[model samples]
Target: MNCSRVNLKNNTLYKIALGLVVAVSISACTTEPTPPVETNELPCRVAGYFKSQDRVGGFYRCVWNASINRWIQYPYDCPRGLEFSEQLQACVKP
Candidate 1:
Protein backbone atom coordinates (compact mmCIF):
# COMPACT_ATOMS: atom_id res chain seq x y z
CA MET A 1 0.00 0.00 0.00
CA ASN A 2 2.87 2.43 0.85
CA CYS A 3 6.34 3.02 -0.70
CA SER A 4 8.12 1.57 2.31
CA ARG A 5 5.86 -1.50 2.29
CA VAL A 6 6.53 -2.13 -1.42
CA ASN A 7 10.29 -1.79 -0.90
CA LEU A 8 10.16 -4.21 2.03
CA LYS A 9 8.33 -6.80 -0.04
CA ASN A 10 10.78 -6.38 -2.93
CA ASN A 11 13.73 -6.75 -0.58
CA THR A 12 12.28 -9.92 0.91
CA LEU A 13 11.73 -11.42 -2.57
CA TYR A 14 15.30 -10.53 -3.62
CA LYS A 15 16.69 -12.18 -0.51
CA ILE A 16 14.60 -15.30 -1.10
CA ALA A 17 15.74 -15.53 -4.74
CA LEU A 18 19.39 -15.07 -3.80
CA GLY A 19 19.12 -17.71 -1.11
CA LEU A 20 17.50 -20.12 -3.50
CA VAL A 21 20.23 -19.63 -6.06
CA VAL A 22 22.92 -20.14 -3.45
CA ALA A 23 21.24 -23.29 -2.10
CA VAL A 24 20.92 -24.81 -5.57
CA SER A 25 24.52 -24.02 -6.34
CA ILE A 26 25.70 -25.59 -3.10
CA SER A 27 23.52 -28.69 -3.53
CA ALA A 28 24.69 -29.18 -7.09
CA CYS A 29 28.29 -29.24 -5.92
CA THR A 30 27.59 -31.41 -2.85
CA THR A 31 28.01 -34.72 -4.70
CA GLU A 32 31.32 -36.45 -4.16
CA PRO A 33 33.87 -36.27 -6.98
CA THR A 34 34.49 -39.58 -8.75
CA PRO A 35 37.92 -41.12 -8.39
CA PRO A 36 40.18 -42.04 -11.28
CA VAL A 37 39.39 -45.48 -12.72
CA GLU A 38 42.11 -48.12 -12.33
CA THR A 39 42.59 -51.35 -14.28
CA ASN A 40 43.05 -54.44 -12.11
CA GLU A 41 42.62 -57.38 -14.44
CA LEU A 42 44.48 -60.69 -14.71
CA PRO A 43 47.60 -61.59 -16.73
CA CYS A 44 48.39 -58.87 -19.22
CA ARG A 45 47.72 -59.58 -22.86
CA VAL A 46 49.35 -56.51 -24.35
CA ALA A 47 52.94 -55.31 -24.10
CA GLY A 48 52.79 -52.07 -22.21
CA TYR A 49 52.77 -50.49 -18.78
CA PHE A 50 49.85 -51.26 -16.51
CA LYS A 51 48.79 -50.14 -13.09
CA SER A 52 49.58 -52.45 -10.19
CA GLN A 53 46.61 -53.61 -8.21
CA ASP A 54 48.62 -54.20 -5.06
CA ARG A 55 50.66 -51.08 -4.37
CA VAL A 56 50.67 -47.42 -5.29
CA GLY A 57 54.43 -47.33 -5.88
CA GLY A 58 54.35 -50.50 -7.98
CA PHE A 59 53.45 -51.31 -11.56
CA TYR A 60 53.42 -54.28 -13.93
CA ARG A 61 55.37 -54.48 -17.15
CA CYS A 62 53.61 -56.72 -19.60
CA VAL A 63 56.05 -58.32 -21.99
CA TRP A 64 55.61 -60.92 -24.68
CA ASN A 65 57.67 -64.01 -24.01
CA ALA A 66 58.45 -65.93 -27.16
CA SER A 67 59.34 -69.10 -25.32
CA ILE A 68 56.27 -69.08 -23.15
CA ASN A 69 53.96 -67.73 -25.90
CA ARG A 70 52.27 -65.51 -23.36
CA TRP A 71 52.66 -62.20 -21.67
CA ILE A 72 54.41 -61.85 -18.35
CA GLN A 73 53.61 -59.36 -15.62
CA TYR A 74 56.88 -58.26 -14.14
CA PRO A 75 56.28 -56.43 -10.94
CA TYR A 76 58.44 -53.38 -10.41
CA ASP A 77 58.69 -50.73 -7.76
CA CYS A 78 59.51 -47.07 -8.15
CA PRO A 79 62.50 -45.50 -6.44
CA ARG A 80 62.26 -44.28 -2.91
CA GLY A 81 59.65 -41.54 -2.36
CA LEU A 82 58.24 -41.94 -5.86
CA GLU A 83 54.88 -43.12 -7.14
CA PHE A 84 53.57 -44.54 -10.38
CA SER A 85 51.54 -42.14 -12.47
CA GLU A 86 49.15 -43.27 -15.14
CA GLN A 87 49.28 -39.99 -17.02
CA LEU A 88 53.07 -39.96 -17.22
CA GLN A 89 53.39 -43.75 -17.57
CA ALA A 90 56.37 -43.59 -15.25
CA CYS A 91 57.33 -43.14 -11.65
CA VAL A 92 57.18 -39.59 -10.35
CA LYS A 93 57.37 -37.64 -7.16
CA PRO A 94 54.05 -37.61 -5.47
Candidate 2:
Protein backbone atom coordinates (compact mmCIF):
# COMPACT_ATOMS: atom_id res chain seq x y z
CA MET A 1 0.00 0.00 0.00
CA ASN A 2 3.04 2.30 0.30
CA CYS A 3 6.12 2.80 -1.85
CA SER A 4 9.61 3.38 -0.37
CA ARG A 5 11.72 6.44 -1.37
CA VAL A 6 14.35 4.06 -2.80
CA ASN A 7 11.72 2.47 -5.03
CA LEU A 8 10.78 5.90 -6.40
CA LYS A 9 14.43 6.71 -7.10
CA ASN A 10 15.00 3.39 -8.85
CA ASN A 11 11.87 3.93 -11.00
CA THR A 12 13.14 7.32 -12.15
CA LEU A 13 16.57 5.95 -13.01
CA TYR A 14 15.05 3.05 -14.88
CA LYS A 15 12.84 5.43 -16.89
CA ILE A 16 15.81 7.63 -17.78
CA ALA A 17 17.91 4.64 -18.82
CA LEU A 18 15.07 3.22 -20.90
CA GLY A 19 14.53 6.55 -22.59
CA LEU A 20 18.24 6.83 -23.47
CA VAL A 21 18.30 3.29 -24.84
CA VAL A 22 15.25 3.95 -27.01
CA ALA A 23 16.81 7.12 -28.34
CA VAL A 24 20.07 5.39 -29.17
CA SER A 25 18.28 2.49 -30.80
CA ILE A 26 16.17 4.79 -32.94
CA SER A 27 19.25 6.78 -33.97
CA ALA A 28 21.13 3.64 -34.87
CA CYS A 29 18.23 2.54 -37.06
CA THR A 30 18.46 5.77 -39.05
CA THR A 31 19.17 5.29 -42.75
CA GLU A 32 22.57 6.24 -44.11
CA PRO A 33 22.50 9.78 -45.42
CA THR A 34 21.67 9.69 -49.07
CA PRO A 35 24.51 10.77 -51.33
CA PRO A 36 24.02 14.28 -52.63
CA VAL A 37 21.95 13.86 -55.73
CA GLU A 38 23.79 14.31 -58.99
CA THR A 39 22.35 17.10 -61.06
CA ASN A 40 22.79 18.42 -64.59
CA GLU A 41 24.47 21.46 -63.09
CA LEU A 42 27.48 19.40 -62.01
CA PRO A 43 30.34 20.24 -64.36
CA CYS A 44 30.83 17.33 -66.69
CA ARG A 45 34.55 17.68 -66.54
CA VAL A 46 36.44 14.66 -67.88
CA ALA A 47 38.96 14.70 -65.06
CA GLY A 48 36.07 14.27 -62.68
CA TYR A 49 35.39 10.95 -64.30
CA PHE A 50 38.93 9.73 -63.87
CA LYS A 51 39.30 9.43 -60.14
CA SER A 52 42.35 7.18 -60.36
CA GLN A 53 45.53 8.88 -59.22
CA ASP A 54 48.24 6.38 -60.08
CA ARG A 55 47.74 6.05 -63.81
CA VAL A 56 49.50 8.36 -66.24
CA GLY A 57 47.12 7.68 -69.14
CA GLY A 58 43.87 7.66 -67.34
CA PHE A 59 40.71 8.46 -69.26
CA TYR A 60 40.50 12.09 -70.20
CA ARG A 61 37.51 14.08 -71.38
CA CYS A 62 37.39 14.90 -75.06
CA VAL A 63 34.85 15.52 -77.72
CA TRP A 64 34.60 12.88 -80.34
CA ASN A 65 33.84 13.21 -84.02
CA ALA A 66 30.16 13.91 -84.41
CA SER A 67 29.94 10.79 -86.54
CA ILE A 68 31.53 8.55 -83.94
CA ASN A 69 30.10 10.27 -80.90
CA ARG A 70 27.86 7.99 -78.89
CA TRP A 71 26.14 10.96 -77.38
CA ILE A 72 25.27 12.10 -80.86
CA GLN A 73 22.31 9.76 -80.63
CA TYR A 74 21.22 11.63 -77.52
CA PRO A 75 21.85 15.17 -78.64
CA TYR A 76 20.12 16.38 -75.53
CA ASP A 77 23.00 14.93 -73.53
CA CYS A 78 25.58 16.67 -75.68
CA PRO A 79 28.53 18.29 -73.93
CA ARG A 80 27.76 16.14 -70.93
CA GLY A 81 29.79 13.40 -72.56
CA LEU A 82 32.33 15.77 -74.08
CA GLU A 83 35.71 14.88 -72.68
CA PHE A 84 38.60 17.31 -72.73
CA SER A 85 42.30 16.57 -72.65
CA GLU A 86 43.94 19.41 -70.78
CA GLN A 87 47.25 18.69 -72.49
CA LEU A 88 45.65 18.55 -75.93
CA GLN A 89 42.98 21.17 -75.20
CA ALA A 90 40.91 19.16 -77.62
CA CYS A 91 37.88 17.03 -77.01
CA VAL A 92 38.76 13.36 -76.67
CA LYS A 93 36.56 10.33 -76.48
CA PRO A 94 36.07 9.28 -72.91
Candidate 3:
Protein backbone atom coordinates (compact mmCIF):
# COMPACT_ATOMS: atom_id res chain seq x y z
CA MET A 1 0.00 0.00 0.00
CA ASN A 2 2.79 2.45 0.93
CA CYS A 3 4.61 1.72 -2.33
CA SER A 4 1.47 2.41 -4.29
CA ARG A 5 0.94 5.76 -2.50
CA VAL A 6 4.53 6.84 -3.22
CA ASN A 7 4.13 6.00 -6.96
CA LEU A 8 0.92 8.03 -7.13
CA LYS A 9 2.59 11.05 -5.48
CA ASN A 10 5.56 10.82 -7.82
CA ASN A 11 3.32 10.71 -10.88
CA THR A 12 1.34 13.76 -9.66
CA LEU A 13 4.54 15.72 -9.01
CA TYR A 14 5.92 14.84 -12.44
CA LYS A 15 2.68 15.99 -14.11
CA ILE A 16 2.78 19.31 -12.24
CA ALA A 17 6.43 19.93 -13.20
CA LEU A 18 5.68 19.11 -16.85
CA GLY A 19 2.74 21.46 -16.84
CA LEU A 20 4.90 24.33 -15.49
CA VAL A 21 7.59 23.79 -18.10
CA VAL A 22 5.05 23.77 -20.95
CA ALA A 23 3.39 26.94 -19.65
CA VAL A 24 6.78 28.75 -19.55
CA SER A 25 7.68 27.64 -23.07
CA ILE A 26 4.38 28.84 -24.49
CA SER A 27 4.71 32.27 -22.85
CA ALA A 28 8.24 32.69 -24.19
CA CYS A 29 7.18 31.89 -27.75
CA THR A 30 4.29 34.37 -27.66
CA THR A 31 6.35 37.41 -26.65
CA GLU A 32 6.60 40.34 -29.11
CA PRO A 33 9.93 40.88 -30.91
CA THR A 34 11.85 44.15 -30.61
CA PRO A 35 11.50 46.73 -33.39
CA PRO A 36 14.33 48.23 -35.47
CA VAL A 37 15.77 51.64 -34.62
CA GLU A 38 15.56 54.66 -36.94
CA THR A 39 18.41 57.05 -37.80
CA ASN A 40 19.00 60.34 -39.71
CA GLU A 41 22.01 59.20 -41.72
CA LEU A 42 21.64 59.30 -45.49
CA PRO A 43 21.99 56.11 -47.54
CA CYS A 44 25.13 55.58 -49.68
CA ARG A 45 26.55 58.81 -48.30
CA VAL A 46 28.96 59.97 -45.61
CA ALA A 47 28.28 62.42 -42.76
CA GLY A 48 30.19 65.64 -43.39
CA TYR A 49 30.11 68.98 -45.19
CA PHE A 50 29.86 68.35 -48.92
CA LYS A 51 28.12 69.37 -52.15
CA SER A 52 25.58 67.54 -54.31
CA GLN A 53 23.63 68.23 -57.47
CA ASP A 54 20.07 67.67 -58.61
CA ARG A 55 18.54 66.38 -61.86
CA VAL A 56 18.77 69.80 -63.51
CA GLY A 57 22.12 71.21 -64.55
CA GLY A 58 21.76 74.33 -62.40
CA PHE A 59 20.62 73.30 -58.90
CA TYR A 60 23.24 72.54 -56.23
CA ARG A 61 23.49 71.99 -52.45
CA CYS A 62 26.40 72.76 -50.13
CA VAL A 63 26.88 71.99 -46.47
CA TRP A 64 28.31 74.14 -43.71
CA ASN A 65 32.01 74.89 -44.19
CA ALA A 66 33.60 74.47 -40.78
CA SER A 67 36.85 76.16 -41.86
CA ILE A 68 35.05 79.42 -42.65
CA ASN A 69 32.22 78.81 -40.14
CA ARG A 70 29.56 79.43 -42.81
CA TRP A 71 27.52 77.75 -45.55
CA ILE A 72 28.76 78.16 -49.11
CA GLN A 73 27.07 77.29 -52.42
CA TYR A 74 28.97 76.49 -55.56
CA PRO A 75 27.79 76.13 -59.18
CA TYR A 76 28.00 72.47 -60.26
CA ASP A 77 27.69 71.45 -63.88
CA CYS A 78 26.69 67.86 -64.71
CA PRO A 79 27.51 66.24 -68.01
CA ARG A 80 25.08 66.71 -70.88
CA GLY A 81 23.65 63.18 -70.52
CA LEU A 82 24.07 62.66 -66.76
CA GLU A 83 22.82 64.23 -63.55
CA PHE A 84 24.02 64.62 -59.99
CA SER A 85 23.02 62.03 -57.39
CA GLU A 86 22.78 63.39 -53.85
CA GLN A 87 22.79 59.92 -52.34
CA LEU A 88 26.00 59.08 -54.20
CA GLN A 89 27.39 62.59 -53.87
CA ALA A 90 28.59 62.37 -57.46
CA CYS A 91 27.38 62.61 -61.03
CA VAL A 92 25.65 59.47 -62.31
CA LYS A 93 23.80 58.40 -65.42
CA PRO A 94 20.07 58.98 -65.22
Candidate 2: list runs displaced more than 4 Å.
37-94
| Candidate 1 lDDT score at position 86 | 71
Model 3: pairs clashing at backbone N, Cα or C within 3 Å: none
Each model's C-alpha lDDT?
0.77, 0.46, 0.56
Preferred candidate (lDDT higher): 1 or 2: 1
**Top candidate by lDDT:** 1
Tell me the lDDT of candidate 1: 0.77
Candidate 3 residue lDDT tens string, 1-94 = 6998999999999999999999999998895533322322232132332333233643344455579765444454677877666577777787
lDDT of 1 by residue, 1-92 (tens): 69999999999999999999999999988965333333454677788887677776877777787997866666777888888887899999
How well is each residue in 1-94 modelled by candidate 2, as lDDT tens digits?
Answer: 4578889989999999999999999999998633332233323333233221333333323222358543211011214455546555555667
Candidate 2, residue 52: the lDDT equals: 19
The local distance difference test score of model 3 is 0.56
- Write down the worst ten-residue block by lDDT for model 1: 32-41
My TM-score estimates for the predictions, one after another, are 0.50, 0.33, 0.33
Evaluated with TM-score, which candidate comes out highest?
1
